[model samples]
Target: MKSLLLAVCLILALHCGEAAVTCETVAEDLYPCISYVAQGGSVPDTCCTGIRTLNSQAQTTEDRQSICRCIKSAMGGAPLDSINNALSLPAKCGVNLPFNPSPSTNCDSIN
Candidate 1:
C-alpha cells in the first residue's frame, strides 16, 4: 500500500511539473513572434524558418493553448474571445497552420 501511494505521488508530481514546463516552453518559443505579428508586422523569415522545427515539438492542445496564451498576453489585453475568433481563420481559409500557430494570425487574417 505504501509503495503504491509513493508511485502515485511520484506520477502526479511529474505530471504537474511537465504541465508547467510545457506552458513555459510554449511561451518562450512563440511569444516574441506573436508580439511582432500582432503589430501588423510580417512574420519574419526566421519565424517561418523555425515553424517546422517548433511544430515538431508541439504535440497536444495544452501545449498549443499555452502558446496562444503567450501571444494574447503579449498583445497587452487582447481579449480571449477575439483571439479565439482569430484562430479559427486558417482552417476556414484552407491554410494549414503549424501545430500551434499563433491565434493572432488567424484573428488578424479574419478579423
Candidate 2:
C-alpha cells in the first residue's frame, strides 16, 4: 500500500538524518590540539577553534560518545602527564565538552 511505502521511506529518511561521528572526523578536529595534549603548554588559538567546532558538531549523545571513544583510543597507553594535559584541554580551550577526556572514562555513560 502507499501508506506502508510512505512509512518505510519516512523511517529511512529519519535514520539517514542521524549522522554517525567517525574517528577520522574526530582526529581531524583534534589535530590542532595534539601539541597541547602531548605536553603541558599554552593552548593555541587554532586548537581552541577546533575544540569549539568539535563541541558544536557533537550535538547528540551518540556523537559525544563517539568522540570520547575516539579520544581514548587516540590516547591509548599514553603517559599520565599527557592524559592529564588532555583532560585540561577543554577548560584551557574554554570549550565545555559533554564527556570528560580520560582513558578510563566510560563512553556509554557520557549521556
Local distance difference test values of all predictions, in order? 0.42, 0.70
Candidate 1 — what's its lDDT? 0.42
> How does model 2 score by TM-score?
0.78
Name the candidate that leads on TM-score. Answer: 2
Given candidate 2, what's the lDDT at residue 103? 82
In candidate 1, which residue ranges exceed 4 Å CA deviation? 1-21, 60-76, 79-95, 98-111
Q: Write the per-residue lDDT of candidate 2 for residues 1-111, one digit (tens) a residue.
A: 344334323433333223476666666666677677666679888888888888998888888887777777666666788778778888887778877868889988988
RMSD of 1: 13.6
**lDDT (tens digit, per residue) of candidate 1 on 1-111:** 344334323432333223333434544443334433344334454444344344555455554444444444443344554345335434433446544345344422321
TM-score of each: 0.39, 0.78
